[model samples]
Structure formats: structure tokens, C-alpha cells
Target: MEATEIIIKCILIVVIFAISLVVAMYSTYAERKIAAFFQDRVGPNRAGPFGMLQPLADGAKMFLKEEIIPANASGLLFIVGPSLAILTACIASAVIPWGQQLTIGSTVIDLQVTDINVGILYIFGVVSLGVYGIMIGGWASNNKYSLLGAIRAASQNISYEISMGLSIIALLLVTGTLSLREIAEQQHGFHWNVFYQPLGFLIFLVCAFAETNRTPFDLPECETELVGGYHTEYSSMKLGFYLFAEYINMFISSAVMATLYFGGYNFPFMDDLGLSQNWITIIGVVVLFAKIFAFIFFFMWIRWTIPRFRYDQLMNMGWKVLIPLAIANIVISGVVNNFLNNA
Candidate 1:
């Protein structure tokens, strides 16, 4: 039994990791195609049919590019920077519950990699460490622009993470559990936490944008100012890691958002369908991916629609607006929960 469980876990891990990479790879293609559509231009039609093979071409380009290490830079840390970035980005998917268990005859298989009791905290910890990758990369580059970008990343993450944590606190008050699995189960039958925690969701959404360094919050990598930001000095596959890390982070962020406020794998009338367990589980996974893809599209849509925020404006919103709102949300959720409990 133990060996079978270990084998199941290993398979789940590999599948999830492969999925993350594939999604991250194609996100680059999607971003380009979406941008082209928005701009009334033909996208990468030359690469393949509808440019489906563009991501593969891009990967080949990255791999074939010349590797350059700055003469003055610390070689080891420079490499470590992007390596760490991609590593942290990939690992955050571990706690996300992709769907309910799959039952085949007497065998039951869990979709998630692991269900730690402190799943939310584990995510926070991983996200918090992600900044170090950017910071280390920037500092190791031995360039003023790179250092500045790194500093921006550190400050931005710190500012937004406070509000992010506060927003999660409000969610915790409502869910009354730290385990993500419990949170998903509680939201069965379209009883999504989003309906109850709209304000918290908004706050979290904004912070997610900031934490992932998406547009309007992409001050650290503002090309006009920092010349490729922290990655200016990186080249070849080293640079590929940083770029891939961003898309992977976005993918994981979208998945987390879906899992959290959007009810993970739960859907309306899921029970009414009267499907078999395996069928429901399969459909639940599909529904969860649908939600995740929608969120990813939203992320890309905002990138093209909104101009980047000035650093001061970004800081002010995080410190002044979102933080206060998150705190208020926590208070409101506490009162509401207390009232419901008493009633």
C-alpha cells in the first residue's frame, strides 16, 4: 500500500510539473496572439498553422541564443538567480488541488501533489521566497540598472504582500480553516467564497497582479527605464528561465485564484448531473481548468489594456488603499461570521 501510494504521488508530481511547463510555454504564444488581436495585427501565422508552434520556435531560439556572462558579474549567483526564480515558480503548484480524487474500481487517486494542513501558509512562504531570485539576479549583475530593478522588485513585493496577507486573513475568517482542500470542499455546489468575499477577492486579485509583477505593477522590469529590468545582463537559457518563470508564476497564480475564491473544482448543479464518480471527477478537473484559463486570459487582457503604474502610484495604492480595505474586510468578515454563528 505504501509503495502504491508513493508511486501515485510520483506520477501526480510529474504530471503536474509537465502541465505547468506546457502551460507556461503556451502562455507566451497566447500572450502574443492575444496582443496581436487587440492591436488589429496578424499574429505569428508563419511559424505553423495559426502559429500553434510559435512557443516551440521561441524555445528553440532561446536555447540557440549565445550565452553571455557579464565580465564583472558574479557568475555563480547570476546563474542561480534565474534558476531559483524558475524553481520557486514551479514548486508553488504542489499544494493546489486540481480536482477531487479519481476512483477506478477499488483504487483511489488524489489529484493534488500533497494536502498539507498549512497549505495557504506554504504558498505564502514560496511566494515570499520568489523575490530573492529577482533580487539576487539583479545584485549579481553588477550593473546600476539591474540593481535598481532588483530594489524595485523587493519593495514592490513587500508593499503588496502586506495587503495580500491581510486579504487572506479576511478569507481565513470566512473559511475557518487553513487547509486549501477544506476550503474547496466547503464551496461545493456553487457556494464559492467569492460570493461572500468579493472585497477580499478584489484585494487579493490586485495583490496577485502586484506579486506576479504583471503590467500596471511591472515597475521592476519596465524596459524603458531599466533596459530589461533585472534580466538585462542575462542571456541564452539563463534569460529563458527568468521569462519562463514569469509565465509559470502567472499560470500558478491563476490556478491559485481559481482554487481559492472561484471554488477550485466545484461547480453549480454538479450533484444534479448524477454522473458517476470518475465522470464527475473528470468533469470537475475540466471545470477547474476552464476557470484557470479564464483568469489567465484576464491577466493577459489587463496587460494590454492598462499602462504600467508609476512606482509611487503603485506603492500608494498598496499602502494606502488596498491595505485599509483588506483590514476592513477582515473586520467585516469577523462580525458576519460571529453573527451567523450566534444566529
Candidate 2:
């Protein structure tokens, strides 16, 4: 590659990596503040005005805390576990389109790191790999409770992923493409796929919560049962990596949801603005991020609003309720497609 192209790609990758860490850091503060608001109590107010610097304080605490490994733990796997989790979490953003390309002088810059044709499948594969990190950590800890948490996490991720894939299949039927950027382009303005695949969207959203192990569905890490769950033996920044990965996943999931259903960086009436290409792309990027942050807030809101599901209940919902609905959506979508083709 030319030096300029190499430089640009390196810059994009670094910027994206930094953005993920920063957003994940702040998500903790947002979650605490939101939870406090709902619980009718004051949240963090120390470490900085109105707790704005709380995430930095938390990061510092993580770094300063003593790193500990259980005596019987497989030291290598324990360390590898959190590293793999955070690495996979960050890489998932590579296929995501932050905005349409920008034309600056003689060069055109793509807003995404890479545009693979099978981007959806790529995300699915990466998401599935995340469970290995949790399982390895739990098993390596040599703690029975941690092992149980790993079992729970493995089963939970496997079950939800099935439904998630099925829901995406329904969307694939509608969009006829696996490339996320292409999918976003197809949903130009308000003509988003959500209007056509509402059922699929709901299934995908629920599966997203389950896949992320977020609340109402966080059985693996349900404190009451599994103690601290998979990361029970972890400490210091090692533990922090696992926790931070969840927030990074949340941000990526939010961006994917917006791209798939909410028009990504596209908005209605944007064409009426008559802005230049560069300005329009920038505004689109802003709009896309706005949608992503809104969904991140929703993830936090649900955490504070809902109670955890019992294990049996979580399994039943995934298998009996969600999977069936997902299949039904596929069938319905197929029927509709047949009709449209015939007409």
C-alpha cells in the first residue's frame, strides 16, 4: 500500500480503538448516574464535579489495585481470558460504518476500517468467540462457583445466538445483502428496514440483551447466585477488562442496531439541508453516534429497571419464546417475499 493509505488506515484504527476505550469508560459513570436517578438517590458526586470524572477515577483505581490470581488457577488462561474478551470486543467495530465516505481533495476516505461482504456473519462469529473468554476464565479459576457461571454463560450465549442468527436471517431476506454498509445505504432516509421487519427487530433486540448478558438476562453473573460470576477470582485491571468489554460490546451492538434498523447514519430530510458532501458525511456520522448513544442509555436503563430472570426462565424464554418467534418471522418473511415476487 502507498504510505498515505497506510497512514490513514493506521490513524483510523487508532482513533476507533481510543474511541471504544473512552466510551466504555464513560458508560460506567452513565450507568451509575442513571441507576441513581431511577432509585431516587444521588449518584457519584466526588472525584470531580457531578461525578463527571468518576470513570477516570475508576480506571485509576483498577490500575492501582493489586492484581491477584488464585493459587490453583491456570495463570496463563486466566490472563488470556480477559485479554481475549477486550480484544474481540474492540475488533467488532471494524466492519461498522460510522458514516458514508468523505471526499477531501483528490482522495476519498471511507469511514469504516474494512467493508467485508459477510460482515454480519463476521460479527456473529466474533460474538460467539466472546463466550470462550468467559468460559476459559471461569474454568481456569478452579472455583466451583466460577465453573457454574461459565456453564451458565456458555449455555446462555449459545441459546441466544441461535435466535439472534435466525432474526438476522429474516432481515437478510428483506435486505438481500450481508454487508452492513450496503444495508445502511439501502435504508436511505426514513425508509428503514424496521418498518418492514418490526418482528425481526424485536427478536434481534431481545437476543442482543441476552447475547451481551445484560440484565433481566444476566444469569451468568447474577450476584445473588454466582457471587461475582465468571470473574469471581479476578482482580485489578484484569477484572476491569472483562467489565469494560461489556460496555464496548454495548456500544457496538447499539451501532449495529442503528445501522440495521434505524438507518445508520441516514436520516429523513437530510437531503433538504443542501449541505456539501463533506459536511453531510460529518453530520451523518454525528447522527449515527447519537443513535448509538441513545441505545447505550437504553441498555443501562433496562439494567436498572428490570430484575434478573431465573435460570429456567431465561432458558425457556430463549428456547420456547424467542426461537419460535424468530422462526415464525422467517416463515412470514419468506411468504411475503414469495408474494412480492409473484406480484
Q: How close is each model in CA RMSD to the real structure?
A: 0.6, 0.9
Q: TM-score for model 1?
A: 0.99
Over 1-343, each residue of candidate 1 has an lDDT whose tens digit, in order, gives 8998899999999999999999999999999999999999988888889999999999999999999999999989998999999999999999999999898767799888999999999999999999999999999999999999999999999999999999999999988899999999999989999999999999999999999999989988999999999998999999999999999999999998898899999999999998998888899999999999999999999999999998889889999999999999999999999999999
Best by lDDT: 1
lDDT (C-alpha, whole model) for all candidates = 0.94, 0.92
TM-scores for every predicted model: 0.99, 0.98
lDDT of 2 by residue, 3-26 (tens): 888888889999988998898999
Off by over 4 Å in 1: none
lDDT of 2 at 200: 93
> Cα miss at 279, model 2 (Å)?
1.1
